[model samples]
Target chain A: MISQLFFLLLTSVAIYVFAKNLAKIRRNILLGKDIQLNDNKAKRWQTMIKVAFGQSKMAVRPVPFILHLIVYVGFVLINIEVLEILIDGLFGTHRVLSFLGPVYHMAIGFFEILAFGVLVACILFLARRYILKIARFQSPELSGKPNKDAATILLVEIILMAALLTMNAADQLLQSRGAEHYINAGAFPISSWLAAPLFVSFNNDTLVLIERASWWFHIIGIFAFMNYLPFSKHFHIIMAFPNTFYSNLKAKGELNNMASVTQEVKLMLDPTTSTPEGYAPPTSFGVKDVQDLTWKNLLDAYTCTECGRCTSSCPQNITGKLLSPRKIVMDVRDRLEEVGKNIDANNGSFADDGKNLHSYISEEELWACNTCNACVEACPININPMEIIVEMRRYKVMEQSSAPTSLNNMFNNLENNQAPWQFSPMDRANWTLEG
Target chain B: MSDFRVKTMAEVAASGEEAEILFWVGCAGSFDERAQKITKAIAKILHHAGIKFAILGTEEACTGDPAKRAGNEFLFQMMAMQNITTLNMYGIKKIVTGCPHCFNTLKNEYPELGGNYEVLHHTTLINQLLQTGKLSIRGGAFKGQRITYHDSCYLGRANDIYEAPREIIEKLDAALVEMKRSRTNGLCCGAGGAQMFKDAENGKKEVNLERADDMLETQPKVVAAACPFCMTMLRDGVKHHNKEHEIEVKDLAELVANAMEL
Candidate 1:
């Protein structure tokens, strides 16, 4: 009864904290403008399955691809065991799914193998990030807390897998001894073979204590990790599915035109319609703040894994330019969090603190993009960082009127001559001669 | 040279005739001397194929690709509205252009501005003609010559058109070689996104020079491109490397035109 009461209290606290953070994140994402993405349900489903579930784009690099596949498969399959763990924790039962007999043995046996795979993958990942010091991991944007956050997630995963194996080992030993309250449950072929020697000398009572300690540690660690996701780049684990589903389905180069501006242009061009009475031009043109972007853009920010694949493939970054696509996504996410916190502090309404995305993302970084879509193509989860960069640039040019001198000249020429060049419209046909 | 009569939309309208397509002579094709050669070569191919085509002539304005890319939305909308009105007045349907920037903007973006047309890149049209036997290439000059095709970013990745230009090159009976970064993985030619209008930002190496190095690594006798912006950037990069005299940079239409001896 005491164990069940403790379990209920711990589970309640964990659920409350996790749900609160998730709700906050949802609200922050909802702060952006609405974008209708309901069309083409079939295509969106296909994209989510292929890109996020199948990990199709991640296969471009063979080494990381295989390692990521192992971790991904292991994480997904191991969660089935987590479901059993949850049942056992709630009811103070011992391997509740063991009632399925042989099928239960096979399921536990499969999860044990995957748990081993997860352990090995986490170690390899740690070595790749810290020991091997891959260039992408060492990018300037990931130097501080981002780098530590990644390492912490990996380290915590390693601990969780270790605790799982340890718990299984002790449970197996206790089961062999026919200890009370610890029945002959769970088939641990891998852990038994590996962990038998470590626990052979220990007695049944001590084995029960070891099993209980590891069980508690693993569950608490998982709960803590679940809550940590809202603050970490590992949030992609949950967001990648929705982000891939809502991805832009048009041609990669197609820019999203502002509907209000498009309507204004149409009115100006229409020969039959004149301006409405008391017409007022828009106060702002492009995305100057988080509110100016679409919900999809904000979701993209929260979904970024900060893997630096986008930055690694960016032409501007390759050529030593200021733009790093990963940083662009990260900055948007940071700004969104800042804005979310501000709203929380001000009685459910945000008071302007005079800070925007531009405070972190500089003008040089915005102008350095080639709009080549390389970053979009390289993103394993279909994150379009270039879209954010272009939106910010639209703000700079349209709202601020601070485009580069050459661009200003080009705009002037385009307004006066109907082309980017400074030449008469009649001269457009001067290159041609009669046959 | 063939006596190819290029008619303007105005001429066709006055004559009470309709054309099958409109040749959108993009800004580069109209003003840039080298790109003008590509425009003429495309016209030659269209004439040989007996395709009824008319140009917008002086009524043709920019597609607002550069302006839109450079974040000048007001200017882009203004230019797009004017061009859409002109094209609508002519009741134009199918259009083709040799510039990838113009092709991308016209095909993908113009519809949002209320201008919709069946837009095709020149290489796509040429490949279509070859497939239907509307055009034939003898390959008399380019036969067995080693040629490498550069994928323009706007044409290849943005528009997903990797095979059309390659298909055109293969029709020449030439050995088509690929750079290390070709097709969807192709790099930019450094002149996209209105980069052609200004100097490059500070960087260790110019993007075109790096891409030009990729083409040179293939060691082809001819470097072929389908976009005018790519032609200018690759030509400049080739000139920078002093390989202009050794490796000839030609458009796909030029190769097809030469193969047909037009």
Candidate 2:
């Protein structure tokens, strides 16, 4: 009863802290401008299923696709056993669902197999990151904190799966000894084959103690991981679904037109038209900071797991340009988090810190982009770092009226003669005169 | 070259004749000396295919692709409206252009501003001609050559028109050697998003030069292009490696025209 009480207290505190941090993240994402991304409900759901659920985009990288599938499927399926643990923890019962008979044995057996797979997958993943040192994982953007956050999650999963298998091993041994509290509920297909022989000599009391210790450690690790999720890239396991749902549905080439600017331009075209009532000009152009972006952009930023797929596929980055799509996304989230904390500290109002997205993403990085959809195309969950880069470029050119000299010349000629160069308009048809 | 004159929309309208399509000869197609060769090739193919196409001539203005991409929305919309007014006045319905930038702007970007038309890149139209037997090829000079098609950003990834250009190359009796980065996975010629009109920001290697390397990797004897901007960039890229004399970067229209003996 005392142990059950302690379990309940620990579970409640972990869930409460996680929920609070999640709420703060939600608030930060909502700080951006409003845009309607929910236009097509049916299409959005289908997109979520295909891109997020099916992970169709990962097909490009076959190795990571298969390895990630093992970890993803095994880790998620094994968590079904956590429900049984939760019930057992709260009610102080051992294998409470053992009444399901063969069905319970089958599930426990499958979970054991999955737990083994999860442990192996995690070890391979750690090797890919730390041992083999894959180029995508070794980028400068994932230097300190991001690298630690990812490593910590994989290591924790290995430990958790080990505890689960160890718990099964000891419990099965206790059942064989016919210990008082031991239930012959689960079929330990994995642990029995691997760990049972070594533990066969242990006494029933020692077996009971080992099972209890493993059980407690396994459940406690789960609670700790639940909280760690809110602060780690592991959050992508949850965010990918919604991010894929609210995706860019138009042709990859078609940029979203600025409707406000179109209206003003229409008015400029016809001087006879009068301004409408409740009309206001925009105070600023494009995104200078996080608040100037759309909520969807913020969601995209948070959904990114720093996988570096976008960076690797980037034309500019591949050519050794200053732009890395991964860094652009991480910078957005970092700025959003900073602004979110500032608002929280100041009682729901932001205090200007003389910093914006421009502080992290350089003008050189912004200009280096080709506006190609490679990054948008490369992202498994469709995170659009290109959109953010375009928005920042809009801010620089329109708000600051600053651009490279050659581009300024192009803009001048476009204004004067309706072409990007200093050519005569009369010469537009000169080709018709030529061979 | 055949003494066949390209008609302006005004001349066609005055003569009580209507063209089947409006040839949107973009700024580069009109003014750039090198791109003008591509312009003439497209015209010759259309003329031989018996496709009655008319140009907007002096009436047509820029499509605002560079301005919009350079982050000048106000200027972009102004230019878009300017061209839309002229196009609508002529009651133009179907359009064809050799430049992918103009094709992208007219086909994808203009409809939202009430400038609706059936827009096709010149390669798509050429494919249509071949499919319908309007245009036939006998592989003139391009026969049995290993010609690699560099998918232009605007036409390939931008508008999903990869197969048309490749099909044209195949019809010319040429083996379509593909770059490692081809079709949807194609690399840019470092000339997209208004980069054509500006100096590239500081980088270890120029994008066009890297693309040139990708082209060279295929060991292609000829690099075929569809976009006028891509032609300039690829030509410069090929020249940078001193392979300009060895590899001819010809537009698909030029290849088709040469093959058809037009």
Candidate 3:
């Protein structure tokens, strides 16, 4: 009964902390400007199912695809076992779902096999990131905390899977000895084969103690992992669904028009319409800070897994340009977090820090993008870093009037001649008659 | 070079007649020396197919694709509005262009500014002409010749047009070899997003040069491109490698015109 009380207390604290962090992230994402995404509900749901739940995009690279699939399936199936653990812990029952009989055995057997797969996959992933030193994983953007965070998540997963298998192994040994109060439960086809030797020499009492310790460690490790998600790129495990659902469904080359700018241009072009009295134009044209971006853009930043697929496929990055699309998304998320903390410290309003996205993301990086859509196509989660890059470029040109010299010349030619070249519009058809 | 007279939209309107389609002679088609051959080839194809087409002539302004891509939205709007007004005045319902940038802007971007028309890229139109029996190819000029097509970024990845150019190439009776990166996974020619106007930023290598390497890997006699920008960049890259004598860069329309022996 005392142990049940302790389990309840621990579970409650974990839930409270996780809910608090989730609320904080929600508030941070909401700080951006409003944009409607209510169109095409059916398509959005289909995209969520196919891209996020189905893991369709990850299939491009087959090796990582299969490994990631194993870990993904294991993560989802193990949560079913977590439900049973919660019930058993809270009610002081041994194998609470043993009443399900044969179905319970199938469930336990499946969970053990998946646990083994997750363990093997996580170890291989760690080697790929650390020992093999894949170029994408070792990019400049992932040097410090990002690299450590990735490694830490893999370590946690390995530990959790190990504890689960160890617990099942100990339980199987106890069941075989016909130990009292330890009901003969679960079909440990995998763990019984792989981990049974580790606990075979232990007596009944010691086996019970080992099983209880493994259970506590597994449950505690999960709680720690749950809290760690919001702080890591592993946040994609939750955010990928909504991100894929809200992905831009238009042609990949389409650029979104600024509503305020479009309205102003329409009014200017309409002969029947005139400027109304006291009508003022918008001061800024595009995104200058996190607040200037739409909610979807902010959500994209939060959803980035920092896998560098986009960067690896980027023409600019491959050609050794300064632009890494992964870094652009990371900068946005880091800046948003900073602004969120500032607002919290200053009574729900942000004080000017004289810092913005440009402080972290440079002009060189923004200008290097060819708007090729390679980054958007390569992202496993469908995160569009080009959207952020273009928005920042809009801010650079319209808000600051700070385009490069050649672009300024081109802009001038466009204004004067209606073409990017410095030639009169009258000569547009001259080539038809010329050699 | 072909003995065909091009009519202007003004002449058609003054005669109380309308053309079946407007040939949108984009800036490159008008000003660039290399792109003019593509324009003439397209005009020849239309004439041979018995399709009545008219050019906007001097009344047409730029589609402002470069301006919009280079972050000059105001300039882009001004140019787009002028062109839209002119097109709406003439009641032009169908348009065709050889440039993907102009095609993309007219078909996708101009509709939001009240400029709506059925826009088709030249390769797509040529494929249609062949399919509908409006135009037939002899294919003797390129009989069994090895050719490779470069997918333009604006047309392939942006607009999902992977088959039209390839279909046209197949009609040429040529062996269509594919580069390592082609179709949906094709690499950029490095001249997109208004990059044609500006010098390339510091990089390990030029984007065009990298793409040119991909094309050279196929080792075909001709590099076929549908976009004028792709043509310019690929031609320059071929020149950079001093392979201009060995491999020729031809627009899809030029190849089709050759196959038709027009």
Better lDDT candidate (1, 2): 2
Compare candidates 1 and 3 on TM-score and give the better one. 3
lDDT of 3 by residue, A1-435 (tens): 999999999999999999999999889998888877879999999989999999898998899999999999999989998999999999999899989999998999999999999999999999999999989998888989999999999999999999999999999998889998788888998888898987798899899998999999999999989999999999999999899998888888878766577668877777566666886878888778999888888899999989999998888888888899999999999999999999999999999999988899998998888888888888888899988888888889888999899999988887787678888878888876753
Lowest lDDT sum, 10 consecutive residues, model 2 chain A, at A426-435
**What is candidate 1's lDDT per residue for B1-262, written digit by digit as tens?**
2385688999999999999999998988988889888889999889889999989989998989888888878778878888999999999999999899899999998998799999999999999999999998874688889999998888887989999999988888899999988886788888887788877778788888888899999999999999888898899989999998999999999999888988
Write the residue-wise lDDT of candidate 3 on B1-262 in tens digits.
3387888999999999879999998988888889999999999999999998999988888898887777767778878888999999999999999799899999989898889999999999999999999988873798888999999888988899999999988888899999988876688888887788888788899999998899899998999999888899999999999999999999999988888877
Q: Candidate 1, residues A1-435: lDDT per residue as tens digits? A: 798888889889989998999999999999998999989999999999999999999998888898888888988888888888889988888899888998888888888888888889989999999999988898889988998999999999989999999999999888888888887766897889877679989998889889999999998898899889999999999999999999899999788776667767777777566666886767787788887888999999999999898898777788888789999989889999999999999999989999998999897888777888888988999888888878887899988999889888888887888777888888887766823
Q: CAPRI verdict on model 3?
A: medium
- Output the worst ten-in-a-row residue range by lDDT, candidate 3 chain A: A267-276
Which is superior by TM-score, 2 or 3?
Answer: 3
lDDT, candidate 2, A1-435, per-residue tens: 899999999889988998999999999999999998989899999999999999999988897898788888887788788888999999999999899999999999999888888888889989989999998898888999999998999999999998988889999988887788887788989999788888888888888888899999998898889888777788899999999999988778888789888778888899766777887876789889999999999999889988999998888888777889999999999999999999999999999999998999998998888988888888999899988988998999999988788888999999999999999998888877655
Q: Candidate 3 chain B — worst ten consecutive residues by lDDT sum?
A: B67-76
Query: Per-residue lDDT of B1-262 in model 2, one digit per residue for the tens?
Result: 4479899999999999999999999999989999999999999988888889899889888999999888899899999999999899889999999899899989888999989999999999999999999888864678889999999888877788889999988888888888888888888898999988878777788888999998998888889999899999999999999998899999999888777776
RMSD of 2: 1.7
Pairs that collide, model 3: none
